[model samples]
Target: MHDPSLIKVGSCYYGFSTGFEGGPGNGSITIRKTCDTTITTGWTYVGTIWNSVPAWITTRLGSTPPNIWAPDINYFNGQYYLYYGASIWGTNTATMGLATATNIEGPWTDQGEVTNVNYPIDPNVVWGPNNIPYITWGSWTGNGINMHVLDAATGKLSTTDNNLWHIGNGLENSTITSNNGYYYLLGSRGNCCSGVNSTYYTVVGRSTSITGPYLDENGVDLNSGGGTTILTGAGPEVAGGGADIFDDGSVKRLAYHYYDANNAGSETLNVRTLFFGNSARTGAADWINVSAPIYTPITGGTVTVSSSIENFGWLKSTVNDGQESSVSGAMGWSSSNSLTTNHTEWVQLDMGTNKSFSQVKLFPRTDGANKGYGFPIDFTIQLSTDGTNWTTVTTKTATPLPSGAQVYNFSATTARYVKINGTNLRTNPNDQNAYRMQFAEIETSGMNSGNLAVLKPVTASSSYEGSDWFTHRVNDGQKNAVYGSKGWSSNSSLTTNHTESIAIDTGAVQSISKVDLYPRNDSATQLGYGFPIDFTIKVSSDNVNWTTVVTRSAYALPGNSVQSFSFTSQSARYVKITGTNLRSNPNDNNAYRMQLAEIEIY
Candidate 1:
């Protein structure tokens, strides 16, 4: 299945996908359904839109194309619309066609050949400023993504304004969605159909207006081949692309396909919850994975780096996310700061339970200026069951200055904790000439991956009801921005007294060593920890008797730093932080409040 789109009916989810194989569905659209609430599983094929290529398309092109690819599904006023593309391979252009039905399981009326353009392959329907239906199609050409204002009544090209609006370039399967005050154009780059060697990945660019120049996280224009990548190949999945955006009310999701390395390199479907990272002035923040994160999941997992530059959505967990940009990726774990680590910085992943893995792969940021810019000068990978004890699995003492994924293969080892300790750091002239340790992603193979704290019970002393500040988000695996993310924060009323607390019951407490705390990465509250001045971290075995692990006062402002509180190992089911003297809210003119982007206890 390639280029899949979804819509939920009363109680069922219907998936419309591009099908080019098998008997009845070749060269037309395929239909599938999953009754399960989780949209990823239990999908059974229904049928195709037609037994063969629609007669209108074959006659219009005067020949049969190989297949109908990239079918985008949409439900329009009093009807359902299916927009797709058909092309003979190697031609610069393909014909984009539309079909409509009252019910999704269609005897779809072929609305033939909508946009007249140089090359139109993937047609996606996005409503514009006035809720006006606009056809965003074309790609597989140098012309980039072009837009056609659709006639609202017919759901086809508008007669009045058929002028093509050239949007961003260097992407395909072009999809656009809006949030806050910005519009994002997400598309696919690289090849997709190849089996194991497929290099397909997703990239994104955003604009303030619906149509115009779009830029990536680092403000690179998309027309010049610039867009931030949100997901890529890792673990059992490879060659991820054919992207679409699904807005499920409170959250936006990225639905794409990847070649399954564990499943004979088959093209498979995957949907992960998309998250907004640190807010930029253009409202174009990098995307972070909240649920169904990109890499091999470690059950009850948490990642803490030795030190990091916490701005621009670069967090420790970003390494584990596995979403690296196709071009010069910017948002990754970078330790280019004044933190005192004795010139050694480390990134550690705590698998909730002991797991087995044979290989670890670390990727350096594609900073474009320097090939091995953020690649560690020298590093050693270690594993440990008890967090305190460690055994070196592999070490690269040599510089190994390469710009791609550095795979370190070792014998299968079992451990709850794994880390890459960078002994010597690379010089990052981009970052004030600081000694830097950076990685775009960290991946482990042959290990059981799952989120243990997802949907776990959470309790907070005070929480803002709306504005994306629900308390349960601390351990939900999604890292969102302070403004856009549903991170936990106190209501504005609690500005003076600092009695706020947040605790996560990690089901059962195992060997706990450290806690990772992320302050909201909103551009407004750029540095300060929203108002967590003085706090005591305590653990409880039965939720009644508590043991205070560490108590600190006069904690200085983190200034976009991920605060890691390491303490003596505690055996407890619950971990809580109670603030005594909460920090002052910078935006509120130094009024005190308690806020946190996320909390991970391990």
Candidate 2:
């Protein structure tokens, strides 16, 4: 929910049914504050009628459905459409249903059953190209898991209901997302919300199509029970499987719930924040609870340091040299006295030649005095290659603050990024004050060893609204776009008719290596085309002269998918994407809306 008057007006949410009876009394769908942890004292219930009565429940039916499992909510048509599952425990006779309401607090109307399969449960709905509706669900029976197209006008299944993929043996609760051409599925592998004994966790699979043959990170089939465990139970809090996967524009995350044995039936929410886990944010299988949500402080100017602390109730030792938001990329560090509170002051670190850093140091800030080791405080310093899956480094109490200038010798830590975390607050133990974090000069590490940085256009191709396709340059191989300081003058007239090309001023680049293209189908007046878009990749050292690098026929299918072409080339000044053709039009048209990802010149 958004508005021009408010940054974010409100949001709607749904969760597992509470199994209450009489009316929708036992079931629940909630909408509350996005950043607020406190649940509203009162809730607007949507009633407890199941989408379909299981054979077992029908046999024992007193009047209503037995239990409601997964509840998914999506906004459409000025109202909220909720897709959920209903079934009797231990029976595969599960069914899916839809309900609509004008507001989160509503008089929800049941739209009838969309599926009558014996194993159709845990339904998740998504909109594909042209606003076409689609639903993905996991089951314990039949094909195991599948995806189906839903009618846009009526929330009913279309003829496109194919068993898209399958998950073998002991798996349920699957979700999917299409980004940069890859459709990722995050599925639960064990039991979830089962008090103290559910052994549930999460696994992930990816494919280029809505329906698959989905494969794990290792390229194993998900239908054959193959997947890379994205998350699992590591502590007493995580017991079973309950997963909800989503992307927040920049990064993808898996949100799930687990039961804590120590707390007795206390199910807590956990999120696995990621950025292409294997390629960048690796080893993210470690489960982190949502009990204490922490967000890093951001600033417009320079600061010595900015940090956030996640409370786990007990003290933890630092594992790695900490990471800070200011240490890396465009939002880099700088110092300013525009602080309104003494408890928290803005600190900045110089990005230097690059827009970010590799690491830094943090200490206690007692009236701007460094308390590196004066206090016996437990600290947790973490680092992320992509600022998501943070890995702890070390947890040692410093000897003390050096007598001279509140500085400590952390040696040459070789960190392009750094973060400082602390405990032992005088006011509230649960909440750590951002101001107490003492800091000093950061040892900015050298640049990355990768190829020269590539610039990716932020705006989409279809929305080529003048400012689209602009180049935001970077000194290192970092992915961020800063304004004014370091950017190339973007070419706005790059959009072509069948054979379009954009030439970069190679005076800035030392060499050229790779190119990535993003294409969004534009079916404005008609139904648009389907997969298999043929095109050629050409390069030129000079705008007038060009050479074909790689020529191959390709396709841009019906759903969300991205295709890329890479080849080695001489230091070229111009890069062009000459499309000979695209998917055949379903409604009849030659119009193509293509999106570009990045072009790398090393």
Q: Which is the leading candidate under TM-score?
A: 1
| lDDT values, one for every candidate | 0.72, 0.44
After TM-score superposition, the amount by which residue 220's alpha carbon in candidate 2 deviates from its true location, in angstroms, is 0.7
For model 2, how does the per-residue alpha-carbon lDDT over 291-401 read when each residue is reduced to its tens digit? 111111111222234442323211111211232212222222222222233333223332321222222333332223222322224455544333335445545454344
Query: How many collisions between residues are there in candidate 1?
Result: 6
Give candidate 2 misplaced runs (Cα > 4 Å): 1-24, 28-63, 141-143, 160-169, 247-252, 277-602
lDDT tens digits, residues 1-602, model 1? 67888777777778887776544556578898876444665588888887778887777677887678888888878889888888776666578888899988988888888765757877888877978888787675747788888897887889998678888675678888876677788888777677879877777778888876888878788888897776656547797778777765444667778888876888787776655444322322333333454223343368888877777766766777657542333466877565333378898988776665666777787756755676777889999988999999888876867767787766556687999998877776665666778787787763323433444567888788677777766655555454546477776553466578888876554546677787777664545556476889998878999999988888887766668887766677788888888776656676666887777765
lDDT of 1 at 213: 80
Worst 10 residues of 2 by lDDT: 1-10
TM-score of each: 0.56, 0.44
